[model samples]
Target chain A: MTVILNQSFTGVSIGAVLLLIALGLTLTFGQMGVINMAHGEFIMAGAYTTYVLQKPIGDAGVSLLLALPVAFLVAGSMGALLEWLLIRRLYTRPLDTLLVTWGVSLMLQQLARDIFGAPNVQTTAPGLLTGSVSVAGVNLATSRLFILGFALLCVAGLAAILRTTPLGRRIRAVVQNRDLAEVSGIATGRVDRTTFFIGSGLAGMAGVALTLIGPIGPTTGTNYIVDAFLVVVVGGIGRLRGAVITAFVLGLLQSVLEYSTTVSVAKVVVLVGIVAFLQWRPQGLYTVRTRSLV
Target chain B: MTTTSTPPTAAPATEPPAGPPETPFLGRFLGRFRTPAAFLLGAVLLVGVAPLVLSDFRLGLLAKYLCYGIVAVGVSLAWGRGGLLVLGQGVFFGLGGYAMAMHLKLADAAATGETLPDFMLLYGTEGGLPWWWQPFANPAFALAMTVVLPMAVAALLGALVFRRRVKGAYFAILSQALAAALAIWLVGQQATTGGTNGLTGFQGFFGYDLNDPINQRMVYVVIAVALLLLMAAARQLFVSRYGELLIAVRDSEERVRFLGYNPANVKLVAYVVAAGMAGLAGALFVPAVGIISPALIGIVPSIGFVIGAAVGGRASLVGAVLGAIAVAWAQSTLSDAWPAGWTYLQGLLFVVAVGFLPGGLASLRTVLRRRRTSSDRVGATKGVTT
Candidate 1:
């Protein structure tokens, strides 16, 4: 029972990171239908932002706090620039975007390598986040708890913005009916760029949360990108609630499976399970109702 | 992915219907024979000129590039002609390569009077060969299994995925997941799979002494001949009636459905055929390269096929072949000079070529556009696509 509780806590924490990484993908990929292969690099950008700030800022704790919003802007602007420069041109052709963004991903990865060097880099966890606390006879890492709390907070903040704000209304309108939204005087282009900014900024935040647990490298984001993408895919295109539920479920399933089997076997099993699940529900957990004919 | 993920109206203005290009009598006459002419020239270059001009070492490199060219030919048919982005072809390639590799390893073991591969002994396995590897001991069975395994896997996956109407980025992502899963699985099963180093240290290939330069040249000839034959077969498929239906499905699935055609089955056939070609490529790749590892057929190597096809012109058989060869050649030469520059160059090349190429297959885009316009008219009147 103790092991179960501890493992589940670990699982939920992993799910939190997965959810965070997927949050931005959910917006750009889900709502926009653009497969941004380089979104992973944006997460890398965020982690690098945290790394870059620690140089001048003496206090690790203060730097970590300041890094969140700064990383968001850094990654968000990069996404907007990508949107304005490349992705915007290939809106009609989604497959082309995959190739182009893959190219961009390679360049970004190389850029990271050139700037940060090939080896992995470590960050000092703040004094507040370095330790653990015991709860219900199970020891939980403070960083894990922080990540969970941070993820939930992000979810609430995103949900609030999407449901209540005017910008959210515009995003929904653009997503539902781009032509109709345009006719109604909504600039779909700006909405697209803004949506990309927020989505990528969320990915940046996810990156910030990632450094709390482990040392990050240039390819750190690459490790999580596919899993993050799977979350978006399984959750359904453009459905926040579905993404949240799916991420947690997959995370728990992975930890439980990993506990029983080897890591590689666990990964293979999860993938197969996901594929089988896709077979049963092709439209995903929560498919958007669309009237467009192909 | 989807033409547009927009929920409301499709907005037809975004997808401008294509009209047929005006071709004169001479152009039509030339077009009729250009495909065949292209293959003929390719055959001459590989079979006749290559052996005479290039050294054994250079010829060996060409043979290896031709193996990738084989995979690219299938990519042309699947992605360019059929519009199915096959991102996980590496898995199929790995499957076929492993099958052939298993046979060679078994042959080597038999020659040495051992029941286990050298790696198995090093790892201290108590048992003989694994139950799954028993059939691969037979050379004939292993040879057949190379093509059969990958095609069977493709058929099974195609049935499931296509039936569900899963496509576009979903299909691409699913395929990539398969590649990742296979690589991870192979790495885990060290004793059975030979682990990270993969299956290597082969002395012979089908009774031919691999150490001899003469036999190596013979191997190159076999690869060149197989490549030519496969390209011919693919060219035939491209011009076939089935190819037309595949295009119809790509251009407009509903229209094809209305005409009483099953889009899933059409796609499944193309996918299976492509898998068969990739399997052959992998089988040939094993003996030519003297190794087959997860590193060679992982997510990155899978995209290499796409890039090759894209650079050459995905729709055109000759273009895909030459494109693959050129890309492979460039990688071999350029990476030797400056390893880091090759990646940046490849990335830049992909962005520039595919970004400007008007759907990564310029000729095919025009073809699809024209086909869409005609299919619309025909669907309204005769309820069929030409």
Candidate 2:
């Protein structure tokens, strides 16, 4: 019973990290209809931001706190720039977006390698977050608990903003119908840029959280990319609530499966499961009814 | 059947599947001649002229490139003509390659009178050859399996995917995931598949010495001939009514469905054909390149196949072949010069191609011609007015 509880905790923590990453992916894909393959790089940028700040600040906790916002700003600006330069022209061509963004992804990965060096960089966990808490024979690490909280906080904040803000309203309007939104006096382009910024910023925040779990590297983003994409896809395109639910389900499932089989086999099983799931629910967990929208 | 055998000057008996009806008999004749003429010329250069000019070593490199060209041609058909954007040719390529490689290993074992291949002895729990590797002992069976395996896999996969009406990004992601899954699976099964440092140490291919210079040259000749033959087959598909149907499916699948034609079947045929070609390419690649591994059959390499066709212009057969060879040649040359820089260049080229040069190198001529014609018109008008 303790082992199962511990496993479930582990699953929840893993699910938190996936939720953070998939949130950004869900927003970008849902709103813009653009598959940004460079998204993983944005996450990498955030993690690297944390790495860079750790040295100068000389306090792990303080640096981590500073790194989150800095990472968001840096990744967000880069996302907006890419959106303005390359993505704007390819809105009608989703497949072309895949190819172009893939190119962008490769370039960004090389850039990371050049800047950070090829070797993985380790970041120390904050002093307060290093220890574990035991309850009923289950030892839970503080860092995992913090990550789980952080993920919830971010999701809540995003939900609140979307629910209450005029910007969120504009974003929703544009997403529903760009032409209609334009006629109603909203600048769809600004909304697109803003959404991309927020989405990439969230990816950056996920990166900072990622460092709490493991070492940071140029290829770190790639490690989570396929899983994150699957999360967004399975959750349903353009549905934040669905993204949250799917992420936890996938993450927990993988965590449990890893205990029984080799990691590679577990991954294969998960992938096959997802493929089967897709066969059953092609539109995913949530589908928006639209007229003649292919 | 005789129509296909007729002289280049002969008017085609079969009506061209596409193009305007006003296209004259002479235009149709030229259209028919164009592909075969190009094929003959390319065949002559590859089979006849190349051996004379290139050294044995260079010819060997060209043979490896021709294998890439073979895959690229299929990519062009599936992506360019069919608009399927298949990002997992590596799955089929690996299928073909492993089939041939297993056969070679089995045949080597039989000749030596050994119970199992060397890898099995080195890595397996039991010393005997696995049951799956048993049929590959026959050279004929191995060859057939190379072609049949990919086709069957593609047919099954295509039926599932297309029947579900899963197109666009979902299809691309699923296909890429398959490549990734296959690679991981292959890497995990070291005992059976020779994981990581994949299947090598072959002495001969059907009694031809791999190390002998003459036999190496013969291998190149065979591949060059195969390339020409495959291109001919692709060209036949391109001009056929089926090709028109594929284009229709690409443009608007729903409209095709409404017209009472099954878009899924059309897509399935192109997908299967592409997979078969990729498989054959892999079979040839194993002998020429002397190795096959998970690294060659992963998501990255699958994308690599599409990149070659994209660079050459996916719609043009010659372009696909040329693009594949050019990209392969460029990678070798660039890597020799700067080991770490080629990927950056490749990425940049991919971005530029997708963004600005959507039609690839094949479209450059038309762009230039349009500019020249406009300039000439301006010149002629200025002179008349003056």
Candidate 3:
């Protein structure tokens, strides 16, 4: 029972990270109708940003806090720039966007490889997060708990922004009906730019958060992009809450299965299950309204 | 619809003028060499003669291209006409490749008088094949499974997604994620699936020696013939009622649905057919290349398959085959010349292709034809005046 609990906890912790990475992807893919294949690269940008700032801050806690905004800004600006330069042309052409972003992703990966030298960067846990706490006879990593809390906070904060802010309203308007919103003078283009910024910024934040539990590498983004995409798809397009829930479900399933059998077997079982589930519910667990006839 | 309504009201658009009395035979002969026909002929001839002209090393390269071409044909059907953007053909390819590899490995073990392969021993497995792998030991069963498994998966996935009306980027991402997950799982399972190194070091296929020059040339011939058969099949489908329906569904699914056709069924047929082709390609790839690995079927290669199809003109059957072979050939040559620089060259090609030439190499003929016809008209008009 204790072993199960520990595995479940570990699963939830990993799930939290998956949720963070996927949140931005879901928004871009689901709401904005842009398949940003380079979203993972944005997360890498954030991780590198955090890594670069670790020394200047003098402590892990301060460094993380400082890194968050810095990472977001760096990634966000890049996202906006990408939107202005490339994504804007691919508005209604999703497949073209997939190809173009894939190209951008490769370019970014190569750039990172050149700069970072293909080695995993060491990220130190803060003094407050370094230790472990015993809960129900299971030793739980404190950093994981902090990450869970931080992820929840981010979800709440993002939800609040979407629900309350004027920019959020414009984004929602643009998402629902681009032509109608444009006719009403909503500046759909500007909304696209800002939304991309926020989405990419979130990815960057995810990268920084991932550093607490894992090593940062140029290709680290590639490792999580697939899982994050799965979470978004399984949860449902344009559904933020669905993404979070699905991430936890998959993460927990993976952890428990890995503990019982082997990691590889667990992955295959989970994937097969997910593929079957998708076959049954193609729109996923939650459905969202969109302009697409499909 | 609005564009369709517009007629040629502005002028007769550069009319053809009188020329010297034309020889019907010459005109007919020249017409036979027109772009599309010439391109088709060139491709067929190249694949046919390549084995004869090239060394053993080059034949191996051509064999790999043929595998890529097979996958591209499927991509053309799914993404080009069906508008499905299936980024997970790699999963099917891997499935077929691995199945064939398992059978070959098991066959080798039996011949060597070992109960299990060397890798199994290294991994601390008892000298016996796994239960799931047992079926593959039968050559006929392995071949059947190689094609059937991927098609079944595609059918199931298509039925679910198409029925629910999940098309476009959402479907693409889902399929891509599936490929990624499968690759990861395969890489992790060193005992069952050959880990990252994948299944290599094969001695023979069935009883025939793989090292024989005649056999290698025969493999190339088989690949070329298979490619031709696939193209013919694709062409037949393209000109059929089903093909028209598929295009109709792609252009306007609601209208097709209103016309009493199930768009889902239409899309599903193409999807499943594409999967089968990819599986067949994979099965052939295992013996031709002597390996099947996670690296070959990962996210990158999946995208690579699509890029080739897209750049070759996804809607064109010949384009898909040629484009795939061309890109694969380029990659091999470039990588051999400058491994570090090949990726950058690929990126450049992609950007140029997407940004400037949306229809790819296939459309170049259309452009040239237009220019030639216009020039012919100009020459005829000048001749008449003179």
- Give TM per candidate: 0.93, 0.92, 0.89
Highest TM-score model number: 1
Model 1 pairs whose backbones collide = none
Clashing pairs in 2: none
Model 2: per-residue lDDT, tens digit, B61-80? 99999999999889888888
Enumerate the candidates' DockQ scores in order.
Answer: 0.50, 0.36, 0.29
Q: Indicate whether candidate 1 or candidate 2 has the larger DockQ.
A: 1
Which consecutive 10 residues in model 3 chain B have the weakest lDDT in total?
B1-10
Quick one: best lDDT, which candidate? Answer: 1
Model 3 gets an lDDT of 0.80
Give the lowest summed-lDDT range of ten residues in model 1 chain A: A285-294
| lDDT by residue for model 3 (A177-275), tens | 667888999987888888899999999998888888888887888888888888977898666789989999988998999899888778778877876
Supply the TM-score for candidate 2: 0.92
Candidate 2 residue spans exceeding 4 A from truth: B1-32, B369-386
**Per-chain TM-score, chain A, candidate 3:** 0.96
lDDT of 2: 0.83
Give Cα distance to truth, residue B305, candidate 3, Å.
Answer: 1.0
